[model samples]
Target: MSDAMTLREITDFAENLARKAGELVRREREDNTLRTDYKHQTELVTHADVMADEFITGAIRKRFPAHRILSEETMPDLSQAEELDTPLWIIDPIDGTVNYAYGHPQVAVSIAYAEKGQVQAGVVHAPFSDETYRATKGEGATLNDKPIQHSGATEPRQSLFATGFPYTKDKLEPLINRLNAMIHQCRDLRRIGSAALDICWVACGRLDI
Candidate 1:
C-alpha cells in the first residue's frame, strides 16, 4: 500500500481505538465495584486500565500482527530497540489513572503510531468532554475534527502553562523546584492530571506550554 494511504488508515484506526478505550474508561469511572491497585508505592491502576490496554493490544494484534506494542500496563520486554524495523504502537489506555479512579474527567486514552522511533500519527480521546484530538506527521493537528493552532505566545508572562507532578515524594522535590521557577515566569500553572490531555490542550490553544 502507498505510504499516504497507510498513514491515513493508521490515523483513523488510532482515533477509533482511542475513542473506544475512552468509553471504557468513562464507564469504569462510574462503576463503584471497579477495583483499584497500586503498581508502585503511590501510582494507581484500575481494572479499566488493564481492560483498555488489552482491548487495544488485542485489536492491534488482530489487525496488524507484525507490529510491536509498547503499553503502560503491559510491557513484556523492556529491551526493545529505540529504532524499530517494524511499526510500534505506544499506548496509554488511561493516561490519568489517579483522576479516573477518583471519577475526575481529566483522564484520556492516548495512542501513537511510530516507526523507526518517529511518531507518525497519534490520537488522544477525552471521553468526558467528548473530544478527539488527532495528528499525523506533516498533517498538523485537529480537535473534535476541527483544525487547531498553538497559542503562539512568545512571552512567558503571557503563557498559561500546564504540567503534572509525579506521585512519589522522592521525585517531587525537583518537580517542585521547576514549578517554582516556572510560576515566577509564567502567567499561571495548571495540573490537569493527564499528560496526553495537557499536550492536547497545548496543541488546541488551551495551554501555552
Candidate 2:
C-alpha cells in the first residue's frame, strides 16, 4: 500500500473489511454454538470474536503489510510497538460480544485507519440490520452510502442520549456521576452494548451522545 493512497481509497478498504467481518459475526450468531469466555471481570469474548479478528487481521496484513494493526482480540504490546508515525489499523471485530452471544442484534464490526495518531477513515457495519456507516477525513459521514448529519437538536430536554459503563469496577462512580448528570436532562437514556455502534448512532443522529 503506498502512502500516497487517497482517503477515499482507505475508507473504501475499511468499509469492505468491516462488512466481511460483520458477515462472519452474523453467520456465527446463527450457529448457536458460540464458545464464550470472560476476558476480565465482565468483558466477554466469544469464539466468533477471535474468528472475525483473525479474518480481519489476515486480510489487512496481506494487503497492507506495513500498516500496524491494533485489534481488540489481538493487540500488540504498546511497549514494543514503534512510534505513532506509522499508519495504524484499529479493529473491533465483535463490538458487542455479549449482545451477540445473547442473540441481540446491536452488535457490529468497526475498522478505522489512522496515520500519525489521527484517524483518517472509519467504517462500522451492523450485519444483522445490513447497515454500514462510513466516514473519511475531510468528508462527511454516511449511513448505507447516504450522507448523514447529526441531529440539530440543542435542548437537552428534547434529546435522546446513549451511554455505556466500562467493565472495570472502579470506574462505576465516575460513570454514574456522568449518567446522573445526563439522565434527567435528556428525554431518555439508552445503554446500548456496542461502543462502535453507539458512535455510529450518534453520527447518524439516532442518539445525542
Candidate 3:
C-alpha cells in the first residue's frame, strides 16, 4: 500500500476503535456495572478498562496481525517498545477512571499508532461529550471532524494551563512548586483528570498551555 493510504487506513481504524471503546465505557458507567480495582494500590482500574483494552487490542490484532500493542490495561510492558521496527499501537482504554467513577464527564479513550517508535496517528474520544479528536503525522489536528489549532496566545498571563497530578503523592514537592509558579505566571490552571483529553483540549485551543 502507498504511504498515504496506509496512514489513512490506520488513522481511521484508530478513530473508530477509540469511539467504540468510549461508547463501551460510557455504557458501563451509565449502567452501574463497573467493577473498580486499584493498580499499585494507587491508580484506579475498572472492568470497563479491561474490556475496552481487550476489544481494542483484539481488533488491532485482527486488522494488523504483526503490529505490537502496548496497552495501559493488558500489555503495558514497554521493554520491547524502545526499538520499534514494526508498527505499534498504544492504547489507554479509560484514561480518567477516577473521574468516570465519580460520574465526571472527563473520561476518555485514547489510541495512537506508531511506527519506528514515532507516533503517526492518534485519536482521543470523549463519550460523555460525544466528541472525537484526531490527528495524523504531517497533518493538523481536528475536533469532532473540524480542524483545530492551538490558541495564538503569546503571553503567559493570557493563557489557561491544564495539568494533572500523579497517582502517587510521595514526591509532590516539585509538582506543587511548579503549580505555584504557573498560578502566579499564568491566568489560571485547570486540573483535568484525563491526560489524553487535556492534551486534546490544548490542541483544540481550549487550553493555551
- Superposed model 1: Cα runs more than 4 Å off: 1-5, 76-82
Runs with alpha carbons beyond 4 Å of true place in candidate 3 = 1-5, 76-82
The TM-score obtained by model 1 is 0.93
- On TM-score, the stronger of 1 and 2 is 1
lDDT of 2: 0.86
lDDT-better candidate, 1 vs 3? 3
Q: For model 3, what is the alpha-carbon lDDT of residue 134? A: 91
Residue pairs in candidate 3 whose N, alpha carbon or C atoms collide under 3 angstroms: none
Tens-digit lDDT string for candidate 3 (1-209) = 22445787778989999999888999998999989899899988889999999999999888777778888745745665758566778899988889998899998999998876778899999999999999998888888889998888899999999998898999999999989888999999898999998888888888998
Residue-pair clashes per candidate:
0, 0, 0
In model 1, the number of clashes is: 0
Residues 40-101 of candidate 2 have per-residue lDDT tens digits of 65788998899999999999899888878899756765563446657888898888888999
- For candidate 1, lDDT tens digit of each residue in 1-209? 22445787889999999999888878877667679888866788988989999999999999888888899755645365465677788999999888888778888999998877778999999999899999988888999889999989899999999988777777688888888999999999998999999999998899999
By TM-score rank, best first, the candidates go 3, 1, 2
Off by over 4 Å in 2: 1-3, 77-83
Clashing pairs in 1: none
Question: What's each prediction's TM-score?
Answer: 0.93, 0.92, 0.94
When summed lDDT is taken over every stretch of 10 residues in candidate 2, the lowest stretch is 76-85
